[model samples]
Target chain A: MGRVSLAGVSKTYGDPGQTVTALTNVSFELADGEFCAILGHSGCGKTTLLNMVAGFETPSAGIIRVEDQPVSGPGWERTMVFQDYALFPWATVRQNVAFGLEMKKLPADARAAIVDHHLDLVELTGFADRYPDQLSGGMRQRVAIARALAVSPRVLLMDEPFGALDDQTRRYMQEELVRIWRREPKTVMLVTHSIDEAILLADKIVVLSSRPGRIKQVLSVDLERPRDEDSPDYLALKRYLRGLIHAETAA
Target chain B: MSGAAAGTAVPVILPARRANWYRRLKPLVLLAGLVVLWQLVCLLWLPRLDRQIAILLPSPVQLASTAGKLIATGELPHHLADSLRREAVAFALALWAVPLGIAMGWWRGIHQQFYPVVEILRPIPPLAWIPLSILWFGLGDVQNEFIIFLGMVFPILLNTLEGVRQVDRNLIRAARSLGAGEAVLLRRVVLKAALPQIVTGLRVGLGFGWMALVAAELVGANSGLGFLINDARSLLRTDIVVVGMLAIGVAGLTIDFALRGLARWLLPWSQQQGGR
Candidate 1:
């Protein structure tokens, strides 16, 4: 139910006479229950592409469809985890996780259960009473993820969700996310610049070139679960992806 | 390891506690010194130099006696209650600015329509409206309230506008993606995010409104601290005049203190408001 398809998407900003193109005639498909990473350098419009799917922005020319329905405005069916972990500062962790359920007008009893379940899922069960400011960066992002997943959306969009965390925390969170995905599968599109991250988590990797981004390569990861970074195949794929990105940057 | 760390921490905390104690005492000590100097000048120094000038500046002991008589007679409390009531009604009336400001901040067309009008009116002092207010409401509670409202509404409205405009864009997007509609988003997200700033606006507006209320009462009312001050001045009761002025100062400080406490309670997540 969560398959997403993009057909010839392009985005342009500013007036017609003086315009800046961010994405150019890009197209790709994400199969249901698959984890795909859109890997690119900064300012590469990877985030813009993700935003269009999340319905925060519209493509100037092209179509994006989720579950065979044309993408429209933001809805509960498609949720996102932001890099900044935009949890409401005033709301407690439990309340933040329960936000979507509340929006859906779920009964209090049902909402509480779902909130507890998701907070437990994100391993923030003991921190439900804390405000966003009281938590560390990694804990706040966990709250964001828990908040997004509590709604049980069909498609999950993460825009560099762990980019703000330290290297150790980021690696730890990657494994935690993998563990969660294995237990409860959902369509996920992760946009990031980290190659190891993409290789470790994604079922498919779509690499885009720099500014005015267009898909340069779409490689499927045939590796087994919990792929080792030092493994020969993992190293080889990382090397190959690095070469592709370096060529684009050099050019 | 823990024992040594605690031992080192003890010395640091001792100095910090002493510094905090000094900080708290410094202001009160200075205020006490100033009061003693005022008593000295009025009772011991000024009377020798000029008896008339000494009579004009009442000594602390003289002011205390005047204040005690006013309190026993209930005159001071009556005036205070009237002034506070006028301020309360006008401040409550001015709260309509919050929603209007949200509209202006959220919608470009509304902002374009209302901004110029606000800018034109905002710079005009509340005291400037006293004459017109008296003409319209004819020297009663309504006249005083109108002046206070004029003083309050602009600050509340402008701060609310700034607050709404400065709401983090990502919070709105997150709420939307979580299935919150426009109205829901405004009520649940935007309003909560802007609350600390709104409270700040309320504080500033209350101060302005209190000052405006006193000014309005001076010109066109019969029963307020301002009226009492003016009445005392007419009768050459300098002690009562000083009492009325001190009442106004204490009342203003109390109002601001209460609003700050309310803001802290309402917004526990906001450390910036507490810092102010």
Candidate 2:
């Protein structure tokens, strides 16, 4: 189950007189435990699409469903990792991870165990007591990922989760993310402007047109794990995707 | 080699220790210098100007003796306790502003409804409320507290409102996505995020409340530092008035120092927030 499906989704902002369409008739489906990346230019409403799926925003038209149930609002079943790593500043890493479990009214012992496990999963077990301010950006994002995973959400939404990091940290975190996903698969939808990131992580990459984002192409990534960017096939795919985005941007 | 290492260590450590000691004593040294200058003026300049003016402005020594007598007679302590009690009660009562402010900040309708009323009332100084407070409470601690409350509530309320308004929207969304209900989000995320600003509001509010309390006591009460100052002025005991003034300054400084300590303890993560 746990298939996320969007049918003819459209989102418009502002009043009827001067409406700005953020998304227009976008339709896609994420299969159970599938890793899907929505690649688009900045301000293409990729984040808006992710928010709609995560139930932070509602589409003006069309429906989004997961497991045959219509998505309502933010729920425990879906958790998100933000680019800003929105860990509660007042909370320690452990407490941030336990927040979802606490909301579920889980027993203290169970919550603690889950928190420990997730912290270990993110390789931040040594920093469980530290506040978010004490952490590097990468470490903070790891805590956020741990927090999202501690809930064992059916759907994991990441909004350009590594976009803010330096290049080295970004590459390291991308690998870390893949390793974690391989260990514990979830229906992951990562929105990013980085074509390399999309190719490296996603099973399927859905490219979108510029503002008033529409699904332009949905290409399956048939490459093996640890995708080699220098390989002929990988380079060819990158060139093709870049050409597609360049055409949209130039237009 | 060991002796050379020790010699090098002494040179490195001695300067740092000396610098820290100097830093610690710098303010006190300046304060002492000012006091000496005041005493010198009292001895040489004020008396030469006029004996009557010298009597009106008591020297530090004269003020100290007056203060000693008041303390020995328990008069100073009694007045201090009375003023502190009024301030404490008023501050406690004013704490209701926190929740009310959060409500106003969080909900648009509530903010729109209450903000205008607050703006209209806030501009009227707490001392301005004294005549009405005395009429309502009949010249007592309640009257003094009412005035202090008026002085305190607005700073706290407005600061809390701003704090809540400025909370990171992403934090609220993160909490919601984690299954935090509205109440849970407000209590856990919103309140914690706003605490630094709330502490700042408390500090400013207490200062205003203390000043208002003194003013109210001067007008309508029989005991307190303000009353003592007024009484001394009426009796021409300028030494007692100066001592009372000193007590007010010292007490306000102590309250602010304690609040700074509290803020440091409460927000170890937010070391840079809220200027002294």
Tens digits of per-residue lDDT for model 2 on B1-276? 599879878988998999999999988997899999999999999999999998988889888888999999999999999999999999999999999999999999999999999989989988888888778889888999999999999999999999999999889889999999999999999999999999999999999999998999999999999999999999999899889999999999898988998998888888675356
* Predicted candidate 1 versus true structure: per-residue lDDT over A1-251, tens digit per residue: 79999999999999998999999989999999999999999988999999999999999999999988999889888999999998999999999999999999999999999999998898999999999999999999999999999999999999999999999999899999999888879999999999999999999999999778999999999998888888999999999999999999899
Give RMSD (Å) of candidate 1 vs. truth.
Answer: 5.2
DockQ for every model comes to 0.70, 0.74
Top candidate on TM-score is 2
DockQ of 2: 0.74
Model 1: residue A95 alpha-carbon error in angstroms: 0.7
Candidate 1: Cα lDDT at B145: 93
**TM-score, second chain, candidate 1:** 0.91
lDDT, candidate 1, B20-112, per-residue tens: 999999889978999999998887899899988887999999999999999999999999999999999998999999999999999999999
Q: After superposition, how far is residue B132 of candidate 2 from its true place, in Å?
A: 2.2
